[model samples]
Target chain A: MRAEEPRLDAAGALAFKDHLREAVRDAPPRVVLDLGAVDFLDSSGLGAVVAARKFVANGALELAALTPAVARVFRLTRMDSVFTIYPDVPQAIAG
Target chain B: MPRERVRFRADLHAVRDALIQLERGAVLGPLTGESRSVILLVLAEVMNNIAEHAYRGEGGEGSVCLWRKDGAVMARIVDRGLPAPAIPAATDTPNPADLPEGGFGMPLIRVLVRELAQSRRCGCNVMQLCVDDDNAA
Candidate 1:
């Protein structure tokens, strides 16, 4: 699922979490979140992404297409090492 | 550029809007993309800290004043809410293998800004952040 919004900050973190929960209810074996269009991601958003991983208990939560700003959050927090990051959705899905 | 100020409510939504306004303003508008992102990230962390911790997730009024001079962008955020924790010189990076859900804000702020100072004055929390021109570092 791609994040349509330009920003995934504190204001949108909770809603994003809720949406992710709903999206994976059927428990797919893997979920790849495409964040190509997301220009910004604050710590709250990063936290939401981390929390979303827990919801996919039976599956994996992978991230794709991190824009520079979003990538910065993941890198600085060392979350880049935590999530399976891919250059794009196709690569993430290919894995 | 001259100092620019934005008054906003201490809520996530308002904070986001305030950032948009500031980013488009004179102080930040002409910065390199890398520099702009650094300034925005640091300010967002500081403001969100005020909204989430100081305001206890409740809404309150606050202001962000910004100035770009001396080869740096300086920001001062003021809010009338509970005081925040001390601004540590360094913060530990949470182990990602633990899948920690939170605690990235302070460390992000610490790494992105050139200088940070937090203090409470007359029942208000004031946070000052300085991002150098060569923020690409």
Candidate 2:
């Protein structure tokens, strides 16, 4: 469970994306992105999630646990259906 | 027509809180479920842009106003900061593939609102957004 609060901009988006990649690099087959602390997100943040989904799709890794605001972005773009969303870290990992 | 106005420093969190207040105050009353979600998304994106880009995160001041006239919920965001770039000509549909994390703000703002107008007046960038509940029906 790697958590990051990068500056709220493109740099922050890229940092989160890199964190997602690093978390799944060892092929753990399961990952949970904890966005509870993320107060703001934009389209770039949405793209990072999409990128993470593509990265995890290659293996048995699972990505879940999107915060409400983060989940809202996925839902707004209709990408929530594409990614399995859980409410929290424990739930995501348990599933 | 009297309008409700709220002013705050250019803080991302403050902008979001103000939006939540407006949403709860019946500005988007007729919109429920998915429709409400659309309004929230658009509002957050635009407010975030103003805080991040327009004000450059330097803590400038801005005002948000919401007015209900007829069946439409109208909102105007005015910021005393750098002027935003002109609204792009092609705004109806945003290309998800070519979207940059930062540049997608204006495009998303355009699609989320029923109507959008942007201009620079008195050294302030004013963004006008409107949503008609009747259209959602």
DockQ, per model, reads 0.76, 0.22
Residues B1-137 of candidate 1: C-alpha lDDT, one tens digit per residue: 58899998888999999999988998899888778988998889888888888899888988999998799999999999987889789898789998887899888888888888888899998888899978763
Q: Name the weakest run of 10 consecutive residues (lDDT summed) in model 1 chain A.
A: A53-62
- Candidate 2 lDDT over residue span B1-137, tens digit each: 54667786687667756766665655554555445555656666777677788888888888888777776668888988888877775654334444323355566666556778898999999988887654432
Instruction: State residue A70's C-alpha deviation in candidate 2, in Å.
Output: 7.5
Which model scores highest in DockQ? 1
TM-score of chain A of each: 0.94, 0.75
Instruction: Give candidate 1's error at residue B97 in angstroms.
Output: 1.2
Q: TM-score of the candidate numbered 2?
A: 0.65
RMSD of model 1 against the true structure: 1.4
lDDT of all predictions: 0.88, 0.64
- Runs of candidate 1 with Cα error greater than 4 angstroms are none
